[model samples]
Target chain A: MSPVNSPLAKKLNSFAPLSPDELTCLADLQARRRTVAAMTEIVHEGQTDHRAWILQEGWANCYKLVPNGGRQIIGFPLPGDFMGLRSILLRTSDHSFASLTDAVVTEVPKHRIDEIFQAFPRLATSILWAMSRDEAMVVEHLVSLGRRTAIEGLAHLFLELGQRLSLVDLVSGSGFACPLNQYVLADALGLSAVHVNRVLRQLRERGLVSVKAHQVIIHDLDGLRELAGYDSTYLNGDRPAR
Target chain B: MSPVNSPLAKKLNSFAPLSPDELTCLADLQARRRTVAAMTEIVHEGQTDHRAWILQEGWANCYKLVPNGGRQIIGFPLPGDFMGLRSILLRTSDHSFASLTDAVVTEVPKHRIDEIFQAFPRLATSILWAMSRDEAMVVEHLVSLGRRTAIEGLAHLFLELGQRLSLVDLVSGSGFACPLNQYVLADALGLSAVHVNRVLRQLRERGLVSVKAHQVIIHDLDGLRELAGYDSTYLNGDRPAR
Candidate 1:
């Protein structure tokens, strides 16, 4: 897709349905950008600053590193999705995010954010919706870590990532890039690397899916969904125009 | 304190300084209410119907249980905090909440929420602030679990809980009732009960704090805060004030 029609562009357009003139105004906001290599640390845990990043391409995992060698992957950001929304409300971010691939991102300054929220009230509300959705994801993760079995947690995370990426057209059908590696996956799943490898092998043996290279090929989306007890209701977004 | 002068009542009054008439109107909304026992499962996980719960007294925790014998405590809901904000946006919650103590709570039906939102825009905004704070806490926990050590995670959680409870006068000094057992603490911290016990002992041994019979006495609040790397900036309601 052209830059104008990119998923991030579409998301920004959806929030305000920007006028041609407003889109032109947003060009400066768009121009404040950079490309990051895979494994780039976009945000660091315990840092205090206000830079909201919009992922234009590739994927990333926002996480926190716990002591005792445990890690918690909170959420994955896909194309067109915004990270660092917390900075807007809290003035600081307590989590760190790293790119899963060579990715392009646009970073908007905090002052510009205030201008955008003030200029586009509806968009401001939409951003609030975005934050709310992010919170919902956190809640879901809490459930997965707190309640689901290891297999269930893995299946749920896979299903969720697939569904979210698919929603943004980053994935087609049931397959997409796996984003983070097994090491990062271990942190997200609250398990050790060895344990994560064993779970992945069990998943492959069960004919659920395969993670090779960077691609996750879902053999049976429905079956995996069932195994994960996945439900789509938690991921409500603006309905596509009929 | 009388019902009108209660801390929770005063907290709500601080938002808009409700007039006598408005207080009466709001009081009528909770004319019929019930007190729940500690450990009562008030709201089950995966329920679609959402209710706005206003705590008249006591505490509760929103958490989820995994199939693989794990638990994730998402957030501890204090008096004046709202728990089902996700239901407003996501339509369903995958986490269930149980009271941590004998509590009086008023149930505001989801439908009634809009009326309240419209009736008091500031309160509506306050509700949103409460929701945002919960999201902020989730981000902090993601950091605690993902990056911090086991000891830091437990200590951070303790400091956070104490700070929140202190905000509402739940703690007189550095000591406060924890109201959660080792199993629940393990679930919240993503550690084993044995590990959690060890961490708590470490805290005690270091002259940090002490926990006994569901009560946590923070011997050195500032010391615990430093160990946890906690800054109360996120907890501050620094959202759009209108």
Candidate 2:
């Protein structure tokens, strides 16, 4: 995709307009893209580096290893998501980012970001907005793990992913590409793999959703939303796109 | 407390040095203070308001009511912690802020904040740092809920609260004021009140911690940290205070 046609530009443009120069700068940043194989650890926990990355294509998630030999997937970053902006403030990564599939990402050095902030203050505000949105999603995921039931948690996760993908025009009608397996779903939703399988089967039997060829088809989006008590207000979707 | 001597100033100073004018602007913002009784709801979920708040004194927390008729405590804001900065970008609150104790807070109108950003660009960066830090803490809490055992969760909570309180001089030799009760602890840790009581008793029996008359005393801080697998990296304690 061209830089102007990139998912990152589309996602950011959903919040506000970017001038031609701004778009060119963002496009130039993406010109330095690099690809990694599936399950590659892009950055490890406790790693200190002044560089971040933008997910130009494919999916990645952040996770932390538990003391009891388990791992908790903390977040899933979509194509347009910026992976390491949170660490820019602290200069150290607290969790590890691993690609779930063959992926492409653009490394954003600290100096380049500083230049952006210096040249375009408005873009800096938009960057803050993006980081805040990322935090909001994390907060929502916490509620899911702490309060929601197993079924509700699964449903909420699907709904959230669908909504996010929809923002970048990745969703087609009620279906979208979802390459995640039951194990990934289990880790992200705080369930055992067997439990995730059971939940998926139950949802399919109830005509709520179906998975085929690594795609998730939501037959009852409203029903799933109601069951999960999902609300998109936290997503800040109403921000005017200039 | 005077503006410069306020916890908000101290917290902001932890990130970067503020010029006298910047300090005055922050202090002047806090001049319009309001006090609410204990357990008062400051803002409800989905409420749209252009004003944010700074917690000047006492304790407040953000929570969301679950579909199962339970409340999940999303965060506990310490003195000097700014609330609703996330909402400023979204224009709506995703969680409700309630006072855990009689609390003093300063309202910051959005217009005034815009003025601050225009006049003090560096302060704007500091605000971004604060929000990112908040998100990091939430991510940590998510890991605790998803992976940590009940005992470990309780220990982790105590350690985190102690470390945070100590940042504002609220700790004295491993003890700090803890006005929270078992119910509040249950909500925050995803446990029942009875379970919280049991965990507290276990910690005390193990000579790890003790709670008396709204105060928590750490008998073995290092031991508790080890048991909880606690690391303060996410708290950004290494930031230079100016």
Candidate 3:
């Protein structure tokens, strides 16, 4: 059975407070539903064209495959997340996005998205805001990868994901279920799988974090914050008015 | 004598036409100018407040410093480029901006910027567009660092810079001065200084490029493009409806 409510629809409303009629109208623009098994490719690199996908449920990973067959996972989008926006302008997929779990998504055609942009300027503005924010998150990631140590890098990522998920009510506070695999974590952190496992063990030993079969509990928020040198200012979507 | 005009500004205004009045208004906003010798710090990490600066002329590096003294150059801004916008929303400067060469810049108080944003929505929108483009460039950089080889990383940077500078007429075609030292290149490319020298030597040996003093001449554009896998679509700023 599919998830009854659309978390993405709610997210869209939160940005602009669209009415029910508008939401229903907007949802109708998307095409038929699609599903992918866990660890399946949703979009591939070097693909000339793309169809925009709105995640109905499940998680997806957006990444680039290196020429040497190595991988670098740039981002992981949860429910309500949008990928394929790059295709909206570039006429191609710049990076491949794959499912991390059984995922239900709906493809939105480019022509319809353009129509929506014209019909709903506020929605388009919200999208621009979201994409710009996505870019800022990339900025933070660049800073972390280019500057932090392995442990620090891992801590920052955890803190980041926790805070982001919390904003959308996914997590309670300092902890979230990190469903991604260690190999994927390695790619995200620019480390080997062995290195990522060793770091994870070190964190567990230090009482900084606890990870089990499917959950990660950040035991020492303050310690993790110190290790990550993390400040929550970067996560704020609202800024002081000019 | 000062260059009398901003080359980069001219290139940008080519796409989005600005009146002489608008140009003069921008020049006025940059009235309070200051010049720093080479290796001067423009903004520092952990700084509590925002102080905006415009690159008037010369080279500068924006980077984050780790506790162990490792540095990661997030980007290099040229003349007419704006820096410190990240701090505008974050309320604190998390990374440092420093000049690589004797440089001149103009300071605009954050309050003044805020005032302008409120008073002139068009100017504000233009700034927003500029920042969006900046963020897009960083995404490309992340892909390069995460997925490309060291040689390919350097090649992509060169090609990207050449294209960007060409838009500003800084490049005649496939050649332009690097305007940065080997050490700066090292940090920017996430390589050691020794590694940078080796890669440059490799590029030279392969007859792909000739670097003398500060000038770089691309001996093989097609080879460089193939090596970098650069597609201009990502950098294209021409906005279409939706």
lDDT preference between candidates 2 and 3, better one: 2
| DockQ metric for all predictions | 0.29, 0.50, 0.24
User: Candidate 3: which stretches are off by over 4 Å?
Assistant: A1-58, A64-71, A78-136, A172-175, A192-210, A219-233, A236-242, B1-4, B17-33, B45-51, B86-93, B108-126, B172-174, B238-242
Clashing pairs for predicted structure model 3, backbone only: none
Please tell me which model should have the higher TM-score, number 1 or number 2. Answer: 2
Predicted model with the maximum lDDT: 2
lDDT of 1 by residue, B8-97 (tens): 445455443666755655665566567999989877766667675777678888876654445688878887666565665444565787
Q: Write model 3 residue lDDT over B145-169, tens digit each, in one string.
A: 6667789889888887877677666
lDDT of candidate 2 at residue B87, scale 0 to 100: 73
> What does the lDDT read for residue B158 in candidate 1?
86
lDDT of 1 at B62: 82
Summarize candidate 2's per-residue lDDT along B1-242 as a digit string, tens digits. 68777787776776677889889888888898889899998877767788888988899999889876988898899898888876775446778999999999988888887887798888887776677678778878898889888899889989888877876778899799988999999999888999999989999999999999999999998899899998776776344321
